[model samples]
Target: MLSIGELSKRTGVKIPTIRYYEQMGLIDAPERSSGNQRRYSRQGFERLSFIRHGRELGLTIEDIRELVTLSCHPEKPCGDAHHIAARHLASVQARIAKLKRLEKELKRISILSDSGHVGECNVIRSLSDHSHCETEH
Candidate 1:
């Protein structure tokens, strides 16, 4: 058995986050020691590790919950997991595209000369008028 602190150290998950996961039903509540301190089983360690990896991959809590449920039935097909990953990938791709557009607009705005006076500054004029932007950000 491992104490909560030990579990956190081994899993690289913060203590509060581990508690939050327990509250969210993502991980089981660990057993307590005789002195009332939390003691986690090996299963708890593995489950927390799984959650950490899923979060690192940008998987939503709901997605991870669904995956955990799917994992319980080892005989079932893995198509649902694949579908969830595909949806998240599409979302990431869309965000990347929007970021690229924003980057382009910022680059265009940054190159304008300020002319040493706000009244005659191309940068200020461009900012005041959205029509000057080359792309919708």
Candidate 2:
């Protein structure tokens, strides 16, 4: 068995985070001693390690919860995890596309403003013109 501090050291997660995981019911709270100090079993140690690994992979709390539940039933299909990963990938690709569009717009403005006076600055002109918005009129 290990205390919370020891668990933190073993898992590389902060003490407060372990408490937070307990509060979220993602991990079970360990038994307490006469001093109200937690003592964890090997299972708890492994669970903490799993949670830290999930967090490192950028899993959301809900995703982690789902992963944990799925892990509990080892024989069950994990297609949902794959679905979640696909959604995250799509979101990342969409952001990359938007950033590329913004880069093009910035380059266009740069070309339009080169050596222009402040009053004639195309950068300012483009920003002030709502008609230039890629998202709207």
Candidate 3:
């Protein structure tokens, strides 16, 4: 068995985060030593490693919870997991599109600005008047 700190070190997750995960029911509450400190088994380490990897991949807590639940039943298909990933991918694509629009706006602003005084600056005027933008992001 490993102490909570040791588990944190091995999993590269903070002690507080581990506790939070427990509170969120992502991880099972560990056994306690006689001193009342948490002790984790090797299985706990493996479980935490799975959660940490899921989080690093930007999976939402709910998604991770579902994944954990699914992991308990090996007979189930992975379509749910694939659906979660596809949803995240769609969201990421939307954000990328929005960012590309913003980039174009910035480029337009740069072109509009001729280093004129602030009073006559086209960039400032464009910012003040959103109508100057042809596309709605």
Q: Would you estimate the TM-scores of all the predictions? A: 0.80, 0.67, 0.77
Backbone atom clashes (below 3 Å) for every candidate:
0, 0, 0
- Best TM-score among the predictions, by candidate number: 1
On lDDT, the leading prediction is 3
Q: lDDT by residue for model 3 over 50-108, one digit each (tens)?
A: 99998887888999999999999989999998998899889889889989988887787
Cα error, residue 85 of model 2, in Å, equals: 2.4
Cα error of candidate 1 at position 107, Å: 2.6
Residue 55, candidate 3: alpha-carbon lDDT: 89
Of 1 and 2, the candidate ranking higher by TM-score: 1
Cα lDDT tens digits, model 1, 17-87, are: 99999999998888898899889988989999999999998999999999998998989999999999999
Candidates ranked, most accurate by lDDT first: 3, 1, 2
Report lDDT (CA) for all predictions: 0.88, 0.87, 0.90
Q: Which portions of model 1 miss their true places by more than 4 Å? A: 111-128, 132-137
Task: Name the lDDT of candidate 3.
Answer: 0.90
Model 2 vs. true fold: TM: 0.67
- RMSD of candidates 1 onward, in order: 2.9, 4.2, 3.1
